[model samples]
Target chain A: MPFEEKFHLRIPGPTPVPLRVQHAMNRPMIGHRSAECSRLVQKCSQRLQSVFGTRENVLIIAGSGTSALEAAVANTVAPGEEAVVVVTGAFGDRFAKIADRFGARVHRLDIPWGEACSPDALKSFLLSRPRVKAVFLTHCETSTGVLNPVRDLAQIVREHSDALVIVDGVSSVGGVPCEMDAWGIDIFVTGSQKALMLPPGLAFVAVGPRARKVIRQAEAPRFYLDLQAYQEQLEKETTPFTPAIAHLFGLEAALDMLDEEGLENVFARHRLMMEMTRAGIRALGLPLLAEDAVASPTVTAVRGTETIDATALQKELRRIGVVVASGQQHLKGKIFRIGHMGYCDPLDVLTLLSATETALHRLGKPVRWGAAVAAAEEVWSRV
Target chain B: MPFEEKFHLRIPGPTPVPLRVQHAMNRPMIGHRSAECSRLVQKCSQRLQSVFGTRENVLIIAGSGTSALEAAVANTVAPGEEAVVVVTGAFGDRFAKIADRFGARVHRLDIPWGEACSPDALKSFLLSRPRVKAVFLTHCETSTGVLNPVRDLAQIVREHSDALVIVDGVSSVGGVPCEMDAWGIDIFVTGSQKALMLPPGLAFVAVGPRARKVIRQAEAPRFYLDLQAYQEQLEKETTPFTPAIAHLFGLEAALDMLDEEGLENVFARHRLMMEMTRAGIRALGLPLLAEDAVASPTVTAVRGTETIDATALQKELRRIGVVVASGQQHLKGKIFRIGHMGYCDPLDVLTLLSATETALHRLGKPVRWGAAVAAAEEVWSRV
Candidate 1:
């Protein structure tokens, strides 16, 4: 079978893994209970603190970002408790759903799909819901390519109510700026498949001391996704369950790559790619779902015009070995998302813009031969 | 850094992953929502049916074996519901704990740590509990290296109560005989490690029609581990959440390898290795924890004598590049387990035996010379 080395993957997640991370994950398997694995787990957990921008030892769960979100919810909210979810996009709705499923009395604070939840709006929402146990917020609304002002919102949640401030940074943590402690984030979660530059399997949760104490006393019914067991085991440099061992190996390499690149540089690169992608998309005469003020550095959603269908454009891009994400849920056929997170660069953005131009030309839409690429090049030059 | 090519991975789970599978996992990443990934997930689920010896498509989750076990419990037992957990070893205790945490009326029928629950005992125990909702049983207890009589015990459960027969085949699925449908198993779960010849992370669960019905009505609070959502998305050839893409690639390769060497042949190879390891250990004057009649084909637990310390032997073997499992929980210093499943052959067992001899000598034990090797050679020749 042929390999996918040449294919350009621009999806919001399950992003392209670097060859180095792949090789790291391909190393020979070691015993999970062996001293070698124990040391590796301990080191990875410690290093992940730098990525999450927290002093707490991050707890790794062998599951998806959704699993991490569930861990945050399950550990903090019990049945009949109140949780306020800031529903900015699909992922916010997902958090709300999990809260409801766990029997929490959920109050969803809805914003426009591509809009960010302002701190004033959150403060007003939390004013009446004085008995809230936790407030779930999304750092990057992946489904709509919007980045919420999480630090500001978390600060508001802390002052207005007694709710724990939990943030989902799945698609933004490493690529976007996240200062968990300074932001007063009680619980922070991310996944390996997003900006972490690895396959989807492992979920990392960074919890503050207060959150850990709350998790211990929380009455939410849980077993596998419980955060308390993970913390206890993590204190001993092991996991409650057998971890995704190979992913941890890949994570070590990915973390080292991020360290070498420097956290500030990584965030800058993501911002540059997002700027380039948005500029190119705008030049192509297509509308963007998110505004510049709320645009995500990790992903950007572009809307289709009457002349060009988003679904058709996605299909055309895939046919040309460039894959992008189509609109999800109610926005189907309306927008397509381009991922500029982990393993992506200016060159990748240029390639996607070039492919979009070609796909548009093939769809009978008039396009200046290199208008999108030229716009992307202008951003590259300015940066 | 030097590779671990010569090291013997002798743990029960997190078994040695084959080089071919490792290379397969190193392939470039693809969009998880793309048609390619959809096809991959569908094909792997279908192919897994053969390994599980079931007609139902196995639903894969992005987590460890423990997560799969938790899924089974959380999806079937509601709060205040009755469930029977047959506790034969550590894993069985884990199942009971999960059930208990889920607020089920958990009845743990405890057997000796190193012994399997007898069919007669289970039959009589179930007779008094007519309202049992499910029975959790381990096919192979890795802690004690005992293979339970799942088929017979499941048959008895089917006859006596209306309880669903749930089996944990984490360390046995690809290397042991598990006729799920024939044995009347309602729900069966396993993980990517162990006999699957891959690093840990992905969990596979296969459910019968009856089990699905009960799970749909189950009142246990869950979101990430909700199997119903997984089943619905699986019907559309996708997952409810992001899957471990690289592990799925490795799983496809592992399944192909299993197909090449038929499932029966794979089981035979594991049995051969188990026999060889057990013979060598007995010849070295070590006592076997599990009786020969109930010994696991994938792993063998050998107890240390007064003159030999299991902990010291494990340390010495590791110094010589051999890794084995120490007894867990209460048996921490009494026994050492040698894994013989997944990528292990008679040669690997013989190499381990030689290392054991050397370690024993280093630890001031009597010189066995070539006694262990000779015994292993005799077993290898007979096989």
Candidate 2:
């Protein structure tokens, strides 16, 4: 039965958009330069600032999370300038690559996959590289389901070096607590997809005063991804180019949903979902890819066993209308992932765990039929 | 009457999205890496090829029109290599600027603002610059409502130089006739906001064999706008990054609408709409910005007289719940544009013309009360 009619999307992003958000996107598109568009953008920016935990307005771009990551590098770090990029997984590697592509002399601090970057190690690296202009790190490495110590890393950068602390908060911002202003993050980049509960298209970059100053003098060959244009238009409460208007409408609705639920409650819900997913995995005799201390609240990665083919398990789950993500990059076929981010709740996690258990048993792996569900239900009931 | 609730958007690129397309965006989002996603992308690619009038697959990027223009330069034109950028209007100048930003030695062929780049002039320039790696030209210069002869110019490049002919069809592809394969064009770039009848956020670039070969060997510093990554993933029927899935859903529906109407019929409708708009402007005693021979079929630019302030006219139109675009760049306040592109019909054109005449009369410009509407209706009746 193709499951095409109604499938439970469990991928990291293009995460499942809520029905309200989808209906919001059904609204008519306003002209990008119209006063209506300006008002909508202004409202969205203010709400995004609240979600980002920042006082400054967030700049929205009509691209993916990667574009926002590139903007962080292209806007602040000039050619031949030094920046420290901490690589924990695929997304971290991507951040460093974008910096390198923009001609920044990058000091790559590579951490093992499924692990978060240590603040002390990053500080040591910054100490060695005294003239670093920026430090790039991922808050939640989506590829490995590990959450880096962004606040500690930002503090280390503040104490050790005069470098801008730029974070790729693509998968963590709305789902987790990221106080950009209180944490002294110079630049925080995220996408509308993951935890924002919208489809992939709009990327938001919240820039602090220090990064804005650097952007004024930064020499990068950029036009479309230029932050200055976005910044200038943002002052007028509009975007420089044509934005993804439908997505912005969806964003407005998604933000309303988030606000109604309350941000703290949203964070707690994500944490609970992650805990339930982890407990369910443990009950099914599956090992998690990330350590409990570093496990992400947005997505959970499960290590694949020899007996259970991760790809086949994913396929089996998809057949029954559950869609989880297979591993990415080097982790392909080594681990499978279940995304509990954006528009997800306890019931969704329970559904995923139940479906996973069925797929495992059907694939001739284990005999724990309802163990995973019971474990997940325990976490839900306690919450 | 705030007009904010129901304003008619008549901009060139962001033409009004149809009801069906907007409703399509309300559908549930599937995982971007799911089998369903592959099937949808594959179907979208095939339909996009038909719309773009190309045999090759069109690469879809989750960005605005400008990003696709940047991809054209960053993918095929290496830094320090010579390329000819034919400038006719604001978008034309933008194309040159993007190439210059990428460190290309740009030989700019600047034409007047409201005039199309002459094929003979481009041929002469290509003859002089025989070693030019690429030539950038705008198919429909939206800023001034001028349509450059892409077909004739591509022929000139073939006969005069081995340079890759790259055309920015951002506002022209789906509205008018652009035979990519037949015209010997190497690369044709467009956006989803225009005649595609979808909202902004998706950009399409159709590359021919020669351009693909050049892209494989080009040495440009890029990551997100990298065509090579997109080309590689096109084989797998997926995008390299998280795409604007909601926009793609809208795009699929928009393409279905275009297919239902038929491409030839779509072109004819655009042409008729343009003729009607021009006739209305003439009857209102306003001169067109572009000459009749070079005028665009998607949008019509009318020169504002002293009595009729372009900004005031646009504002007045908006007050009556009709929104038209004012001129861009240096032409701002000197002219106004009415987009007759996607999702627009004869009735819409008549309404725009009637509203324009009302605005002109109220602004103290001596416009005959129903002359503009009668002229437009005359053309519509004949059609």
Candidate 3:
């Protein structure tokens, strides 16, 4: 009686949690210190470690992925130190702000919102700021659907200095390949909602041995976001604080689904969805926000013409039970994003595109009647 | 096959999340800026106001309840600001550490573990430091199962100085009556995993007008924990940063469950569980951690004889499909805690008592056979 409608999530995150995952959360709450809870934590951590591409400690925090990002900055970059941040979109700039707040001398290598950061530009920035102790980059910027080459940037950082390479993989990890250990990524952070197919409230950070060494030498006063303390307590199979147990239960279930699909297949599926979505958007005569080569496989951002308000179109899509997200801040009016990350399929994309064509028509924007859906259906039929 | 075992949670916090609540998390993922997500933010805020007992702005954070505590200290009592903290158990010590981390000139009013902080002591501390800008206290210390007299403490804080009254109601909110507006509480925080009968990860902090004004005047280098920023963004019905969407979904479900039961009935049910648990412990000649009057209705901490290692007994309970928590840190070998909050019933108490008796017997500790269960049944019959 409480749930009158079964809403299908077509948006980027808070993706439709599978029934099995929901049932996972309904498990009896065990004492956090109990052996059962610890075993779950341990197993969960291992699964996360595999996704983050690290053998080091991967800690789960009771908050959104941003909390994990904040913890990484607080623990790695100390006061009075310098951090070179490659800013591509809202999330990239967020790291700059967080690093600055922690007293880091932040040097921002700013780029256009929809464009990806150039690896050469990053190399130049690293050379200019040799004293920088850290480099922050977003692997996949959710705001504009641009995927930055973190592996290339990591190589640049390694050649330039001993600065730790930290990647905000919030929307990318499960959607694509992330080889943390092989790529020499020191600190990688992500959220549960995006590619993990779980709810928010759980964020993960895997700290490499090099990053752990930096944390030991750093001098920033931290209590709750202290990764070292969290890891120390975690080694004993306990959290320094009480964890969100239900979210973890859901995460375990989400992981089971991922395991069955296989990480490689999951990545390939996302790529397939990405190509289908892009083809559908192109068929509608719309401009893609990012260049195809650097476009993210998780989400696609389409540039809207002057006559159409992306915000209004988003609302129109919602009215028909198809929800799409608009751009953030300065990019709000220029672009509308469609996410096809975790738990999404070709049919879901077709539904979104069909509803989108209808919404654009209602907004008096010119569009070929059924072109978008036709293009999407072509991809779906093949699959 | 994914769900090999079906579990029904009867633990204190992280209680069995209702099916409706679990389903709520399955809502379509939307961009944080989508109209639907904003409506969710607005509706959830209003619902949270009712639970927090204030019309003030409630900010939701992704972390354990401790993260909210850190935010309270980091946001309100800026560096070098004078503050007083009342310590009774594990959570209380965490408050002190959080204050210390932020460079607050801290003053502590300590009550022995498992005991309640006295209003007189708090009053005296306030008198000693008239310049204290805030006073931190916990309404319920789940670690030792002690519930402090918040109304009395609030009255004392009012008479002593203008210091903001910040109460941690993490484990108390729905299980106890917390009149934040009536008591002039400036900042009140609680987690979903406690009496709210939801999972962890999402923590809510209600900031009154007074607290908001204080935030404007305070100076703390905070980005992820900038509650002031959350307040501003929440006006638009969204978080300043990405939120744990699924956890919020689960919480909305939890709020509905509480509303159906009514707060008064929720409190009454908890009280009954406490009485049943306490009577059983008393009948077994086991001592309770806190004084009878100040004992928390959420959890009952029973002092165990030295021969019975609390941790070992707990492990044994888990081996038999029953789980209970041991005291934290120094209290580890001293007491065993039984949680009766959230979804727990009299039958749960009976099972725990029976398990405890069996565990104690195996550990060479003397126990009157079946006495604790008889005592619990008698008390439950009266209820």
Winner by TM-score: 1
Candidate 1 local lDDT, B66-115, one digit each (tens): 89999999999888989999999999999999999889999999999999
Q: Between 2 and 3, whose TM-score is larger?
A: 2
What are the per-model DockQ values? 0.83, 0.77, 0.60
TM-score of each: 0.98, 0.97, 0.93
- Arranged by DockQ, best first: 1, 2, 3
Candidate order by lDDT, decreasing, is 1, 2, 3
Candidate 2 local lDDT, B35-135, one digit each (tens)? 77788887888889987789997999999999999999999888799999999989989999999988899999999899988888998888888789899
Model 3, position A83: C-alpha lDDT score: 90
Tell me the tens digit of each residue's lDDT in model 3 across B236-283: 889977787777777788888888989888888888888888887787
Chain B TM-score, one value per candidate, order as shown: 0.98, 0.98, 0.94
lDDT (CA) per prediction: 0.91, 0.89, 0.82
Task: Write down the TM-score for model 3.
Answer: 0.93
Report the lDDT of model 3 for residue B264. Answer: 84
Candidates, ranked, TM-score? 1, 2, 3
Per-candidate clash tally: 0, 0, 7
Residue-level lDDT tens digits of model 2 in A333-359: 988888999999999999999989888
